[model samples]
Target: MMHKPEFISPDWPAPANVKALQTTRAGGFSTGNYASLNLGDHVKDNPLHVAHNRQSLSPFLPTEPVWLQQVHGIRVIDASTSSCIETADASFSTRKEVVCVTMTADCLPVLLCDEAGSVVAAIHAGWRSLCDGVIEATVNAMPVEAAQLMAWLGPAIGPDAFEVGGEVRAQFIAQDAQAETAFRPQGDKWLGDLYTIARQRLNTLGIHQIYGGGRCTFNEPDTFFSFRRDGDTGRMATMIWLE
Candidate 1:
């Protein structure tokens, strides 16, 4: 028998046919710090356990998601194709059931789809990727206009728990001065709001119909994985497909 992981479905204004879900850190065979359901093969979680966990998840998805080798940079791939462009930080699909996915521990996971439900994308938006324009790159790649799109943010480190250096804050501020407001001073460091930053990035691209924030990975030990909270932890997957 297999355990069905408890997951969250985004309640955005997406079209009735677009489907998306975010997995929690539950329902798997891994042990120790990974404890269960670690989807990221790049992590030190046992390969067999990760494989089993991924296989178990198949029943819940349109297809096995096109897992990416995220470099925290702005590279978006056409996941509907069978090409092996492995070094992308985001992926999109115009074809049905080609589940585009991104994995994260503390970095923000963002899913986007147009109102027509013709396209869907998953993004890995760490501070570095956010500042480097991953959101903009993804929106640019979509076939629809930005205003026709909706986005959903998944679990990540909250502002109260995500402390960053001055250099990190400066980089985002350099991109858009309004990014300055997303950071609060923490001595020489800053407390960054990953959700707010991601929202602001979407807003800049004209994607205002956003949803699914406020779930903090660092604070919610039972539900999420937080690299900032635990040095060795599992990764959660956020997936989207056009039905």
Candidate 2:
């Protein structure tokens, strides 16, 4: 029997009915680079392993998660109406037990929910989508006030590990001059802080209730599968839903 993954539940003060979980690279059937609980079937992991791994996660949720075919873009779908892997970076749900899920390796997985527990969402924020305003788009999509929404920033490539080119830095700085503060020059390239960038974006939108974001996929090899560190790697997931 396959064991369940080591899941990280958000510590944010979301209402009692709003449940969230972020899976680590543990407890599943995948082997080799996609070892253990690799949830992403698109990553060339064996379909049987992927299916069984996903199935293993079922007892933890109200329904099967609505996984996104993430393209690092800012497209959020309504979780209740979507079926089939939708081409989106984020998803929100109002209907009970409808899971909104995002798969990520080194990319940031942001989970959002209102204090009242009426809405929740999961966002896949890679550098491309992060710079493209995915966080802002998600905040705007939720029915609750931005102030009432609390976010949990999941594990990602930390500043010391995430090396970005000059162009990447320029794009963020172009959007907001203050974005320069989020980047520090490391030789010819720059060390980008996804968590800091996310906070700045969320703060600008008046969302101050943010938690999580210290874990690094690159540094913690045993706990996370970092795409930047491993070419053919598995992906963990961050999911949320209303009870």
Candidate 3:
């Protein structure tokens, strides 16, 4: 029997038809640094295990998720009409059962849906993508107003663990001075709070109903895979779809 992959259900009050799931580094056939439940096929994990890991999610999902070749950019695709493995950082869908998914290790994975449950999106928000406005791009692609949208941030490298050089911080501050508040000086580098930066971006877009941020992949090795902490590691998938 296949072990059921452990999932973290977002606690946000999304409408009944908007479904989402966050995978952890548990319950799969992967081994070594990949450990188990490593869904990312690009990370050098055994292709068969990666395939099995994704297959384990089949019973829970409405359909096979529209996976992306994330380049940490601002591209957002319509999952309902996209081809397989589109090179994009985010994807959203209005059609029912068209699952949109983003894989992440230390980088943040954000799931979004409107209050009416008419649309859904999954974003891969690494610092570069977030600073470059991936969230904005995803929001723009959705048919609903930002005010009607709610977001749930999945496990990511926390503020204390996500150390970055000054240039990375500068890029964010260049976009919006408010981004400065999301970082704290740590010696010559800065500890960035991805959750804070995500919230700031969401709030600016009129999406104030945000939830789920404290979980840290770097801090919880038993539960998540952190590329920063483990140079060679697995990736977790975050999925969302409208029923």
Name the candidate that leads on lDDT.
3
**What do the candidate models score in CA lDDT, each in turn?**
0.90, 0.92, 0.95
For model 3, the local distance difference test gives 0.95
Going through the candidates in order, what is the number of backbone clashes in each? 0, 0, 0
Expressed as tens digits, the lDDT of each residue in 88-133 for candidate 2 is 9999988999999999999999999988899999999999999998
Candidate 1, 1-243: lDDT as tens digits: 566777888878888889898989988888888968888898898999999889988888878888888999999999988466489999998999899999999999999998788999999998899899999999999888999998999889998999999999999999988888899998888999989988888998888899999988999999888898998999999999988
- Relative to the unseen true structure, what is the Cα RMSD of model 1? 1.2
Residue 12, model 1, lDDT? 83
Q: How do the predictions measure up, each by TM-score?
A: 0.97, 0.98, 0.98
lDDT for 101 in candidate 1 is: 90
lDDT of 3 by residue, 15-125 (tens): 999989999999988999998999999988999999999999999998899999999999999999999899999999999999999999999999999989999999999
Q: How high is the lDDT of residue 114 in model 1?
A: 88
Worst 10 residues of 3 by lDDT: 1-10
